[model samples]
Target chain A: AQTVTQSQPEMSVQEAETVTLSCTYDTSESDYYLFWYKQPPSRQMILVIRQEAYKQQNATENRFSVNFQKAAKSFSLKISDSQLGDAAMYFCAYIGNSGYALNFGKGTSLLVTP
Target chain B: EAGVAQSPRYKIIEKRQSVAFWCNPISGHATLYWYQQILGQGPKLLIQFQNNGVVDDSQLPKDRFSAERLKGVDSTLKIQPAKLEDSAVYLCASSPLPVPVYEQYFGPGTRLTVT
Candidate 1:
């Protein structure tokens, strides 16, 4: 079984400040994918960013980027110029590239203070 | 272009009662999933299906929870003799067949409360 871990249970960041959420995984399979999902108060799981395990370059979407260290099995999410709307529960997930269901980490709640 | 749809946004029932939830995936999505999210925890996959055929159901509580996807499209999940522990948000998701690169689209979950 695969497991994803998010070290920070909760984090607070001032609006316009940058924040990074840490995530690590344990897996023997070399081929896998990583994702970060955001769930707001409405409880809808929304995709924030995704990273391919084979890609050396980090994946970025607008202000969202991933620091994916494949050798170390660490994938962290960085939110730049954080806004109050970014405040939500974030989860890191893993899936085998070949075929497998996603394994999710215990989420980290992010609070953006004005 | 539509997202996954789920019914019964909220449900409240007494312990040992029976309840059911429904889900409708995107038009062409062949893979559908059901997940459970407890308070302050990550979503856990309860069951996964590929075109009406179950691909995985390792974590689902077979004793009380049952699910079916008759036409490889819309699906339903049921829990009989509900327990207090069954109180959680049930999420439905769907993705295209095969590739892991395909993102799974989720629906606003159904909140089940067993009192």
Candidate 2:
């Protein structure tokens, strides 16, 4: 079974600053997908970013980017120019090419302050 | 486009009772998923459906939990004789069929409190 680990339980950042959340996973399959999901107080899980194991180039979206090091099984999310709205629970997830079910980490609570 | 929809944003029930949660996926989406999110933890996939047919339910406690997706659209999850430990948020997510780059969209979860 695949497992995702987010060592940090809580993280805080000031507005306009950059914060990085750490994530690592254990998987035998070489082809898989990694994702970062943000769940705000509304309880809606929104996709923040995604990284494909086959692609070495990291994925970036607006203020969100990921440092995906497949060789080390490390996939970290970096939030640039963090806004107050970025405060939420961030989850690291893994899904292999052969399955649709996502394996998730415990989560990291992010707090953004002005 | 409208994202996934889930009913009864909050529910409260005593132990030994039964409860059901409903979910409506995005239009034209071929995949639907149900997840259980315990407090302070990430959402855990309970079941996945591909057009009214189940694809995975390995982690689901079939002894007391059941779910079904009918007509390849709406889905329901039921917990019989709920346990105190069952208190958690039920999340619904949907996505198009597997492609090169497809993402799963989630709904506002239904928070269930079993007292």
Q: Score the docking of each candidate (DockQ).
A: 0.74, 0.68
- Report the C-alpha lDDT of model 2 over A51-92, residue by residue, as the tens digit: 889998999999999999999999999999999999999999
Q: TM-score of chain B only, all predictions? A: 0.97, 0.96
Interface Cα RMSD for all candidates? 1.5, 2.1
Task: Give the winner by DockQ.
Answer: 1
List the pairs of residues colliding in candidate 1: none
Q: Which parts of model 2 have CA positions greater than 4 angstroms off?
A: B98-100
Weakest 10 consecutive residues, lDDT, candidate 2 chain A? A39-48
For candidate 2, list the clashing residue pairs, or say none: none
Fnat values, candidates in order: 0.78, 0.72
- Which portions of model 1 miss their true places by more than 4 Å? none
